[model samples]
Target: MDNKAVEALTEAEAKAELAQLAGALAQANILYHGQDAPGISDSEYDALKQRNALIEARFPKLKRPDSPSEQVGAAPSEGFAKVTHVVRMLSLSNAFDGDDIIEFDERIRRYLGLGDVAPLEYTAEPKIDGLSLSLRYEAGKLIHAATRGDGAVGENVTTNARTIAERVAEGRKLPDIPLLIDGAPDVLEVRGEVYMSHADFADLNTRQVARSDKQFANPRNAAAGSLRQLDSAVTRRRPLRFFAYAWGELSAPLSDTQMGAIERLNDFGFQINPLTALCDGPAGMLAHYDKIEQLRAALGYDIDGVVYKVNDLSLQGRLGFRSTTPRWAIAHKFPAELAWTHLEAIEIQVGRTGALSPVARLQPVTVGGVVVSNATLHNQDYITGLDSKGQEIRGGKDIREGDWVQVYRAGDVIPKVANVDLSKRPEGSAVYVFPDKCPECGSPAIREDGDAVHRCTGGLICPAQAVEKLKHFVGRAAFDIEGLGAKQVEQFYLDGWVKEPSDIFTLGERFSSGLQQLKNREGWGEKSANKLFQAIEEKRNIPFARVLFSLGIRHVGEQASNLITRNYTSWPALITAMDAAAACEGVEWDNLLGIDGVGDVMARSLVMAFAPGPERDSIDKLTGHLNIEDAEHPDIDGSPVAGKIVVFTGTLEKMTRAEAKARAEALGAKVSGSVSAKTDLLVAGPGAGSKAKKAADLGIETIDEDGWLQLIDGL
Candidate 1:
């Protein structure tokens, strides 16, 4: 919401924005993947995702459990039978510019411990803008085809896929996908993209207009809808094509390198991209990318960007993967298109944090094949033609109503006003004025020092803030009550059925027996009402971390919740600790701060939230109706340092501080940043300061880097 650059965000601001981003992205995934319709442009979605990544990079410890960075696509549509992938179909990280590509190559080299001079080859190819499909074959015969639906599971479209293969076979040419291949592995799963050529897409639309059906927005959408049709007859009529670029599960190794593997797939009667080439390094990769970009317009189908992967299969194996993406590969996207549009008006929307975010209403214009009617104004600073630091931007040209502005969606996924045209500005136009009062609740909007945007002083009194908070409470990362979505939350709030989270638990008990029953409400029936009540009842017992995050406390994100709960183990323990730490000094405060990644700012926020007040009262009321489970402990049966509170002081020589902490945590150890009375072991390195002296004074066991390594050796 605050366009004040990712670098300017404090830990608290980043955490809050991350929560909002997670929810938005979750909805986007459902629209794009599950429903075969996207509400936002690809550039807009990419911008939001890129912003999420940037924030997480700056505040790694604040990364939420439901962070969009850890997710891919959406759950499979209910219409299709589910197919669980043998190997998860992960996505690739994106590189927007040449610098990003350079950093990507450098990161891979660093991860694999390869020198700059080392011959680390890479394979570069076009990144197809289409639906991902996995075709599984056994004994050289096509077994099934599945669409990538949320990475781990997919939608089975075997019948629809077979129709395409059959049609290709009837053409009397080499089939795009041979129903049977010779000399293939006993089991093979080829991964590719299903796309429609521009000419074919035009023809399909013409047919759709003749049939009086809804016209598709783009070729990608048309191809997806056609392939995912329940009736294979519908799919057989559509001009769909496949380009094999990767693999999923294999009975044996296809080749020693990525390019070789693609060649092998081609030999097995799959249509491989002819442009796929081996690049010597980053330079060659970029060169090939440029060539591909020049050829993109004439390629007949859609390609959003160029993909680069570690060519050597062994190197790729060594690079491994993150939670939802391969570490060895990245997509270098082409630059976004630019267009000019009129700034019709600006509207302010308040967030759950009470920050007033401005949105730009624009005259609808097409940019990059998508119609854009709106853009993000970010904040008052962005609208006023200055950054948070009071520096001039757009040559100090402030945005005004009735002005023509240049719009672009390159770095940021959200279309932004890049520049204002002074010559085209209306004669009567005046500089835009930001509001000093909450637009929704008439509360006084105040801007704090060092903050970029204005926040409403009103807490729950503001309907906008209250509704957003309620939505967050029922978010996928929080309580996650089934059948309780954002729309339901808003409807219930407007009807005054649910005001606070605790009120939700008592909805059935009070409303079900009253004259104004939920069953009789508009668009509701007894069965649906009963199902909603049952879903709400099921969430009465929730995990401790979810409970903490569900409260929507400032500076407390999913990771912070996990860290605090893991330390205290139970709700009562955390409450007791917070009560003690409210004094702001002593062992309690130190203990709270000692938790790795929990800074003074976050500690203060936790203490304030738990102090006696309306916030604490609400939390108490909510907890009364629910069973709060203890924090889950990792399986540490064979771990040497399980349940031990370990601290690292000064510097770590063998590994980075973060790496050391991660390794220690993997072995079931609590890696604290500061040394406290509860510290079981201290791994002190060079320049060990007050922390080392305190550990000695407390008579805690201290060890050097070598000793620490020796202790965990062979574990």
Candidate 2:
């Protein structure tokens, strides 16, 4: 669907579009985070996410449980052993312009309840465009290293990390990530980006071609792939570098402020970004961002933006975190880089949701040091010189097949066509026509009432949709079957050997019985076939959350599935609850809506999926071949409020409502917005109203703000 201004969207429209945005953002995360390749330009991704956030703000109840606004990177790739971070590696929210940075500062000040002209210090530094790595040291000795996988769990690349500090650069010995340090804390986890210099990347790619290996697309991908290598020797020869920017787990405080902490890290033999500096306020932050953008080309490494963090450590503690990002920080991305390239052709690609997305094939041209051969055409309206609202763009000039176009990559990942050079259009070149049928299945494609893009009506019959769904089922965040990736999924779907999620489980049985002779297939050997079968078999007994996420239901994603499964615990229970809630009115429906994040729209989607239908039949068939584990609960053993449903009401004096909620959650309490029969405790502040009275009527334990604070004192 085309993005409309948030204010223009009705509640219903906002709800529908939010679902589409959630799915798009989720797929983008998988490509960028799990596969180290991004299919959409950074600007496009940010726009979609920003739109989702705006819509959520306008219609708060429409926010989906798996809303992109609350999600971080995709789950870690399954190639390496997973490491659960002691403290989460959160992602930063983005800002595109100086106005956004100013608003960001204003928001921080307001959240901290500061006056309009409050002096709040901030630290600004270059945001490196490379892999995020966290190094752990215990008892002053280097212990292990991890890559930020899904913020919570990461990939263990300890051996490979040890090689980063062994290199020399610019006639100076690079600081080693010291194996041991004197007077260091009992535990420390330094977080930073592992990058490859532009020179090193070129040399490595040259060597790769000489060795008959595939050349990397860019330095970021090259650095990530090298550092994640199973063999440390491979990493040792890659000339990878590190710059410590933040910390994860710390046994003690580094300093009282962000800049001081960085200086402390530098004192302990870690390279700090030389341009990192303290900014007085929003103006200073913007100035530093501009300075970094100017110095970007000379940095010898990839940097897409500048990061700003509130300098005061105490203020940061009060600001706390949102679901996925910290309120105390944001990344102000540099503006898009523009370059002219030939509009070779436009190709329509069908997505799993049946949306026909247009891609611009271009003659390769370098934009910001990366080759740009493809750009997003957005939709039919975009190509026809009109936006989603039928407003003229590019001065009402249509993009033709042979026109020279301007492409831009805002964050140096994916490039998109921004403008067309009408004067350079080839004579007799035709204005491109978007397809009226699905390219893969020849089904009738129709644009919906409020959507911008055309969608195929073929449903499960559409090969593109079916294949994509099957791919998602086996994706890293889902079944994650080894040796079975997108390529394999497509191949299998075309071979008529796998049609649905259930078809995968029966592969081993069918092939073994000669329904298909796997060993004789072109790229298949007996050992490989057995290994594929073994991998599929291993995933039969999967977690409930994965099973739900693998189904590819509308509006249901990893977080949504986890939220549902955590509340329901098991497959049978969830199915039963959904069945009861399908009627849309009852205690069951209320309870489903009461699951904290699940709203009416999401609840209805779940109910429809579980009701008596083709989808449910398919789900049942898939479940028949596997063992589904119950949801795993978080460990809150030592907290006083563990498992308690706590409610905070009225205006808090010491902390903002957001901060109070975060603190309560951290202490193992389930913070609810309203008081209910299930509420165990109520923390009422000044001006407590109906909720406070309701808690008192329910005979729940009631406490003032000081009493609430004292209850969890020193614990």
Candidate 3:
């Protein structure tokens, strides 16, 4: 229990403990950061960590500065602002096979005074796929957010920090527990992951496609992209959520045990994994790990493995950290989900939303970490053989369901029929015919002009549209009603608790008592319910621009929203204008021509939404329930780049480059692309490159960033 025991540790015992710490910490780091899996549950890993920390405390002479117990992940990144991590983020070790597991157990036995009879415990939970970010809260406001760059210093991303505000607020999520610290108006750095929702990722990709922008490979990439935007406004538009699991700096100790700490974090608003549990000892830990293995398919998001941490902080200190990781934790990875099956046939299906998706039928294969015989093909052009005649070649289906098919996860998810063996096709199999009617709503499917996608005009009455619309209405981009997550929205719609956006505002009034029941749930209480209600109230007042975008009108984006807002002046004005415009027999060509980017298709779509029915009624009803932002001209009068494409190629002496660009955008300059004959003037600096050269080549005069600043001052 103290130093005397450690002083008497046999040479083998000392080596064993240190080795255990090294392997465990390394593995945990890999599982959690690299692969998104943990071999041990957070609680179990915490206990092991505490044990190591205690061991180190008793033997200060033997302590290593690089010990997992002492170190955090890495330093701050360079692109964004810098935030010093008050509490160092430690790394973890992991194990990929059973032999490593046995080795872990062997070291555990050697370190502790007890032999075979003294058992160890391990808890397990899914390792979520995400970016590790630390949030610092001063009082209840999120002041700083940083990434676990190497584990120590990190770039300051406060603007992006504001986007994940709900994750660190004590009123929203309880601060990490079992933390030892000092003070009031405390500053606590909460460690967690920022992830993009699957649906949101899809929508983002779709938008990117429409804009002719590059799409991210996965949600993790999407999250990173959103988090690193130079503009906080961009981050706010992203659907990034956080889940807390570790600690950095803390002014006070949170809980007695690791599980207790997580519970407290949940109390504070950090999303702790609900699947975590306490196991008796090593035997129990392994059993729980098996239990998780069984539930692998149902846990919604992607997970690489499970993490186990020692539970008690006091005991964790006894165990101590290695140079790279803590001895207390480990990650148990699930085997890759994969299968091979005959590609029965490839068919293209038109979705409710006009997306032309391809589907492949397989000879019932076990692929979903379970059995899945079918997978989506994504598009029509992916299935058939293209003809030189400028049409799809007939009689050559390219893929037939009865043929040999290679099945694998496309990006480790959404089982895909990767390739087909042409020789194995059944005799006389025919090419797939694209459907002309909606499968779910029975409406005639028609492809839009100048597009390959076939869309059904089912509107709001369609089942798919109904659910999707409700989700969009309550989404982070819209009303952001706290208690109404997507799943709850579906349940409410199905239960008739809500029929539209208005229905969401009425839930508290319609069934406040039922919500109180939610308070009694494992993680909720009266305080939580009240807090959720407060969050809802805070977001009740809507931004007409955001409301318009949230309506899911095709072709409308943030830029479009800005344009709409600039033109309408008020919600009523916007509505009236839309209605009047829609009533006209053709394009309001003269008025439409005034807007720079307004095109025929977008104009027509706007008319369609305003032509009115349920969508119109919903808009009117929503106005009655919420406050809209006051009509005002956007405040962009004095900033330097207000009306110019003033590119800063070199460092600025007046301010940091960030501040300079920010100031430039603040002015009326139309910050443009490459300068040309049309360029009014070029804001060139010391490092000005091709743009400045081109400006000179084009007879456009160039000014240093400072000279430009002076010009803006005059403006």
TM-scores for all candidates: the values are 0.83, 0.88, 0.45
Query: Distance from true position, residue 55, model 1, in Å?
Result: 6.7
Instruction: Give the top-scoring candidate (TM-score).
Output: 2
Q: Of models 1 and 2, which has the larger lDDT? A: 1
Q: CA lDDT of each candidate?
A: 0.83, 0.81, 0.59
Sort every candidate by lDDT, greatest first.
1, 2, 3
lDDT of 1 by residue, 1-715 (tens): 2335888877766765676666567656877787776534555567677888998888877776567888788777756888999999998888777888899988877666667998888899999888999999999999999999989889999999987787663333776777998999999999999988898899999999999998887788888999999999999999888899999999899999899999999988888888999998889999999999999999988898999999999878756667688889998887666789899998998888788877788898776665566666777877889754567889999999888998864322346787899999999888888999999999999977656668998988999998998988997558977778778899989989889899999987777563346667776787777788889999999999999999888767666788899899999999888888885558888888888778776788789989988888989999999999998777787887888899988877775565567678868898887888899999999999999999999999999999988988876
Candidate 2 to truth, TM = 0.88
Off by over 4 Å in 2: 1-4, 11-31, 34-48, 64-66, 74-79, 116-119, 174-176, 199-218, 229-234, 412-414, 427-431, 513-516, 520-528, 638-640, 646-650, 671-715
Error of 3 at 708 (Å): 7.0
Clashing pairs in 2: none
* Candidate no. 3 TM-score: 0.45
- What are the per-residue Cα lDDT tens digits for candidate 3 across 1-715? 2345556654334433543453345334434343332222233334344445656655443333224554344233324555556655555665554655666666654544336766455556777766778877776556667777556556667677566662343333433221222332376777877777667788888998999987765676677667767788878777776778877777777776778877777767557887888765566667777877787667545565678777876555545554447666777655444456777566554322334355676666543323455565433443565322224433444555566766553221234445666767678877667767766567776754434345667766665666767776775445656666667777767777777777767768888585666666665778877876787788777777777766766555444565566555578777766777877833343343234345454566676777768777876787787888844543575544443445455545555454454445445443443454546667666777787787788787778866766776754
Overall local distance difference test of candidate 2: 0.81
Off by over 4 Å in 1: 1-91, 132-194, 224-272, 312-326, 410-413, 513-523, 636-671, 677-715
Query: For model 3, what is the error of residue 655's alpha carbon versus the real structure, in angstroms, after optimal superposition?
Result: 20
